[model samples]
Target: MCKLYQFVPIFCISLSVVCAKECSIVVLEDSNEFIKIADCSRRGLSQVPQTLPRDITVLNLRRNNFQIISNFSFKRYRFLQKVTLSENKLQKIEDQAFFGLSRLNNLNMSDNTLDLLTVYTPEMFLPIENLTVLDIQRNIQEHNNDVYRYPDVAFGVFKKIVYLALDLAPIPELGQGFQNLQNLKSLIFDRCFLKFLRGDTFENFTSNLEELRLTRCLHYFLHVDDNALSPFPKIAKINFEGSCMHLKQALSMLSSYSGKTLDIINLRGLNCPRFNSDEYPFVLTVTKDMMRYLKTVCVETLDLSDNGIVDFEENSLLSFDRPECIKHLYFKGNRFAFTKGRQIDELNTFFNKSIALKTFDYSFIPVRYWLEENAVHHNEQNYHSSNNIIYLPRSLEKLILSNLLCNDIRRHFMNRRGSNLTYLDVSYSYSNNVVIFESNASFTTETLVLDGHFHAALYQIEIVNFIHVKTLLWRSANLLYAMYPLDNMFYKRFITWFRKLKKLEHLDMSSNLLWILPDDLFLELDRLSELRLSKNLFQSVPTQIIFCSTIKTLDLRNNLLSTVDYATRVWADLMSTNHGFSLYIEGNAFECKCDNLNFIKWIQETKVDLDSRSYKCTLLNGTVITVLEAYETMHDLFSNCRNSIWLTVSSTLLGTSIIGVVLLIIYSKRWNIAVFFYRKFRKMVEKNMVKVTLMMFSFHMAGTAYLGLHNV
Candidate 1:
C-alpha cells in the first residue's frame, strides 16, 4: 500500500511538468529568413523575439501588433534574412535599426504606419556586409525628406548588396549616384520611378546588376547611354512586363549594342515591331553583324510578344546564327512569313543542324513562301531538332504549331515522327485546312492543344488513354457541338475524357454551347485556376461554377446575361473578401429594368474588374445606351414624355372652344345662342370673335396633315 501511494505522487508530478505551457519565445539564431510560429500567444504576453533562426528565411509576423524596434534589436541572428513586418503597428526603428548581423537581407516592411528612418550610419549595417534585398511595400509614410538628401555617405553602405526591391519606396528624393550599390544583381523600381528615375538615375547599380525588373513605371523606356548597361560584366535577364516603353532611341541602341552581355531579354509590352515606323527604324534593326552575334552567343530567350509586327521579312528567322547558342524563341503577335524564297534554303539548313535549341512558340505568322515546296521539304525531314522549327524532328521536346498558320498539313497528318515531342499544341490555321490523326499512331504527346475555333467540324475531341497526354488545351473555341451537324457525340465524350485527366492545370472551354454546368463536373478540378467559359448559350448564371475555390480567373464575357444583380450576389457567396478573383463580364446585354438594379449596385462595390467598354445599357424596348449614361438618359426622356402629356391636356381644352366657334362661323345659323347671350352687352363684337376663332382652327387642322402628325 505504501509503494503504490509513493508511485502515484511521482507520476502526477511528471505529467504536470510535461503538459505545462511554457513562456512564448521567438528567438532568432543567426538572422535568417522565413519563420513560422503557430499559437504564438500566451495569456497577456506583450513582447516577443523580433528575429528568427539562421536558415529559416521569410518570417511572417503578420497580424501581430508590435510598436517599435530598438538598436541591435534583431542583430542577434546573423543569417536571418527576409523578415516580414506586415499587418503590424510598427511605429519606428531606432538608429542602427538593423545593424550588427552581417548576412541579414530582405526586410519586408509593408502595410505599416512607419513614417521615418534615422540617418543611416556604418554601425547599423556593419554586422552584415553582404546584405541585400529590402522591401518596404505598402508603408504609408516611408518618405522622410530629412534623410533623403542623396547623402554621399550612404552610398558606400551597400557596396556588396544585390537584389534591391524598393517598389513604392517612400523616399522623396532620387537621383543617380544616390548610393554606390556596386554589387547589385537585380533592381526592382516598381512605380517608384513614376516621380523619380531620370535618364541617369540608375547609375548606382546599372553597371553591375544583371536583372532589372521594372513594372508599372510611367516611363518604362527610360533612356541611357552604352555606358549604362556596359558596367555590368555578366548582365543577362531583363523584364519590362507592364506598360509601354518610354524611349525608342535607347531601346534600339541597347538591342544592337555590341558590348552587351544580355542573354535573357523580355521586350514584353514593348510592341517592338509597331514602333511608329516614321519615328523608329525597323528594317535596319537586325543587321548582318547583329544576326551573327545573336546566332553566335550574345543573347537568348528573345521575346517579341505584343509587338504587332505584321511585315514579313524572308530573312527574319535567318538573321540569328546557328543553333550552337541561341534557343527558346518567342515570336508571338508578329506577322513573319516566307513569301520571298531568298532565304528558305538557309532557314531549312539551319533548322536541321541546330541541336542546342529547346522551346519554340509562334502564334501568328503569315504565309508568303512557296507553300507546296516549303511544306514538302520540311515535312520530309519531320523537323524536330532543338534550334529550328522548319521540320518536326524526333529531337523536338516542346512544339507549338498553330493550325491557322499556313503550313503543310501532310507533315503532321501522320505525325508518326513526333515520338519525342512531349508537348504539342495545334490550333487550326488558314493553311492547315484539313487535320486528322493518322491510324499508325505510335507517338504519344504529354500535352495536346485542340483547335480553339470552328474552322473544321470536329464536334468531339476526347482522347483515349493510348496517348500519354496529361493536359488537354482548348483555345477560345465556341462551337455549339450539340447542334453541330458534324459531331453529335462531342459533348458526351468530352465530359467523360475530362474526368480522366489527373494532371491538367489549364482548361479553356470558352464560347461553347454550355447552357449550365453540372456540379459534378467541377469536382474533377484538382488545382485549376484559369477557366474561360465565356460567350456560351447560358441564359442564367451557373452557381456550380463557384464550387471551384482554386479558380482565380473566371471569364464569362460575351455571355447571355440579362442582369448584373444575380451575378453580384453569386460572386459574394463564392469569393471570399480577402481572396478576391477577376471576373470577366463584357459584351453582356443587361436588361435595363428592375433586374439590373442589383447588377449596378454590385458593379459599383465589388473589387473585381469588369470590361468597361462592353457595358452598354441593353433595354427590352429597342433603345440602347452606355451603362454609365443609362440613368441620365432615362431621366431626360421621361421628362420629355411628361411635357408632351401636359401639352395634350391643355390642347384638348382649347380644341373644345375652337370646335364650338367653328359651328357658329361656318353655318352662322348656330350663332343664335351666342347672339342671344351677348345681346345684353355687345352682341356684334361677340359675333365677330366666334367667326375669327373658327377660321383659325380650320387652318390649324389643315396644316396638321402636312406636319406628319397622323392622329392630329
Candidate 2:
C-alpha cells in the first residue's frame, strides 16, 4: 500500500509539470519573489487554466472564449491579487467561482455578457476580503427589455472595496446592496441612466467617499434635499461634465459643500439658459442666481469654458463675495468682448474683487473697441490718464491674452501694483505693433510668448527690455530683411541681448525667415535646454550655434536644410554621452543620393530619438519618400541608378567610337576609292557603245546588197 501511494504522488507531480508546459503559461519578469504573475490571455481558453504555479498572484485570461465560470474555478488560486476576465464571452459565474482568492484586490470583468447578478450572491465574494477595486462596467445587454436588476444582498460581502465603476450599467436604484461597501472612496456612474440625485443617494458611502464622477448622464437632474451631499465630509473632486442639469441645480448641489474644502469642481459644458436673444446681436450673461450658487463652493480651480457666455454685467460677480479664495480661473472660448466703455469698469471691478487670483486665462475674447485713434497720438500723460486703464489684481501671476485685439498693452501693465508676474502670453493678437516695454517698466517676467506678426521696427527696441526673461517665443514675426529694412539693427541688438541672458533656458524663433545666425550667438546661453529654429531658411545645421551639451530638445522642422553634417556629429556625441534628447527634422528637404548614404545610415542606426516617419528625403529623380522607408531600399535604388548611368554612358561611347572609325577610314582613302569607282563606271559605258555600233554596220551592208540584186 505504501509503494502504491508513492507511485500515485509521483504520477500527479509529473502530470502537473506537463500541464504547465502544455498550457504555454508565461511567468512575468520583474515580479515579487512571493507573488508571481501568470499570463494566459487570448489563448482560446474556454475554461479556467489548471495546474498553474501555486504562488501565482495575478492571472490574466482576457479576450478569451470562456462561456461560464463554474464553482471552485479559482479555488486553487488562493493567493491571487488580480484577475482580468474582460473582453470575454462570459455569461454566468457560479456562486463560489472566486471562493478561495482571499487576496484578490482588483477584479475586471468589463465588456462581458454578464447581465444578471442573481448568481453572484454575497457568498461569492466572501473569500476576497481585501478586494479594493471592482469594475463590472459595460456588462449589460443593450437591446434587452429587461433591465439588470441588482439583488438586495449582491455586494454585501465586499466590505473593503474602495473604488467601483458602474459605467454603462442600468441600475434602477441604489438599494441595500451598496450599504455593505462601507469603505468605498470613489464611485463612477458614467452614462448609467441615473435620473435624480436625492440627498440619500450616497447615504451608504457617507463616511469614506472622496471623489464622485457623474459625467454624460443625459437624463440626470439634481433633486437636492435639505441634506444633499452632506454625508460626504471629505469630498475633494466632483466632475459633473457633459451632464444635463440646470445651472441652478448644479450650484445648489455645490452649495451643500459650503463649509467643506473642495479641491476641484468641473461643471464644463452644462446646459445653461442664455439670458439674451439668439439674434444678430446676441448677448448671453451669467445671472446673479448662478453666481449666488458659485460663491457657496470653496474651490481652488474653476473651469467655466465653452458655456456660451458672451457678456457679464457690471454687478454679475458681486454675489461671489469670496472671490479671494479662488486661484485659477479659465474663461476661454467665450464671447466676452471688452470694449472701451462700461465693460472696462466691469473688468476692473471683477479684478479688484478677486484678490488672491494667480493664473487667469482669458484667451479667445475678442476686443471690439480699441483706442487706436487716440493711442497713436496720445503721449505718456494722456495714455495714463485715459479711460482705457485695465486694472490687474496684485496677486496675478500667469496671464494668457491670445487672440485678443488691442492696440496698446501698456495700459494693462502701466503702474500696476503687482510685479510678481512670472508668465505672460500675447500671441495671436490683432495688434499691428509689438508691445513696447519702456525703460520705466518695472516687471521682469520669466516667460514671454509673442508668436504673431508685428511691426518689426517696434519690436527691435522692445525686445531689449526683457533682460530678466528665461523663456522666449518669437514665432512668425515676419522679421525678414525684405519685410523690415531695419533688420540689421534688430539682429545686432538681439545678439547683444542674447549674450547677456545668462538664465535663458528655452528659445523658440520658428517661422522668422532666419537665413544665417552668428557663430557664437548661443554660446553664452549655458543653461539652454530647448531650442526651436523651425520654418526658416537654413540650408544646414549651424553646429557652432547649437552644440551646447545641455540642450535636450532641438526642433529644426520646416527648414531649407538638405544635409546633416554638423547635426550628425552633435547627435552622435549626445548619444554616446547617454543624454536624453529629441531631434525633430521632419520637414527638411534632405537629399537622397550616395552623398547622403552615411547620414541615412546614421538616421537608421543612431539611438537618438527622431521622428523619422515624417522625415522626408528627395530622391535624385525628385521623388520624395519617408526617411525610414527610403533607408531600407536606398542601396538597391542607388545601385540601379548607377548601373543605368554607366550603361547609357557605355552605349553612347561605343556608338560614337564606331561612327568615328568609319569616318576616319573613309577620309584616309577618299581620293583612291573615288578614282577606282569612276574608272569602272567609264569602262562599262564604252563597252555598251561599241556593241551598238557593230550592229548598225552589219545592218547597213545587208541593205546595200539587197538593193544591188533588185537593180540587176
What are the Cα lDDT values of the candidates?
0.54, 0.70
Clashing pairs in 2: none
The superposed Cα distance between candidate 2 and the true structure at residue 568, in angstroms, equals: 3.0
lDDT of 1 by residue, 462-491 (tens): 244423555566655655553344346655
Residue 285, candidate 2: alpha-carbon lDDT: 74
- Per-residue CA lDDT of model 2 for 1-712, tens digit only, reads 0111110111223332322223333445554444466767776666777667667787888887878888898988888889999999988888789888878999998888776455467677677757899887766555322344565476766778899876533235456777888888888766455555677666665467888887765543433344566777788888877665544466667666765567778776555343222321223477675566567666778877656676666656434556777788887766655555677667677678888888888777664547666665455454444566666676778888777654543334332633566788878877432333334656567898878754442355645666678998888886564233545645566667778788889999899898776667788888888889899998888766545777878889989888788565556457446677778888888988877777777788776777674478898889988777778887677787578778989999999999999999999999998999889988999999999999999999999999999999
lDDT computed for candidate 2: 0.70
Q: What is the C-alpha RMSD of each candidate to the true structure, in Å?
A: 21.0, 16.2
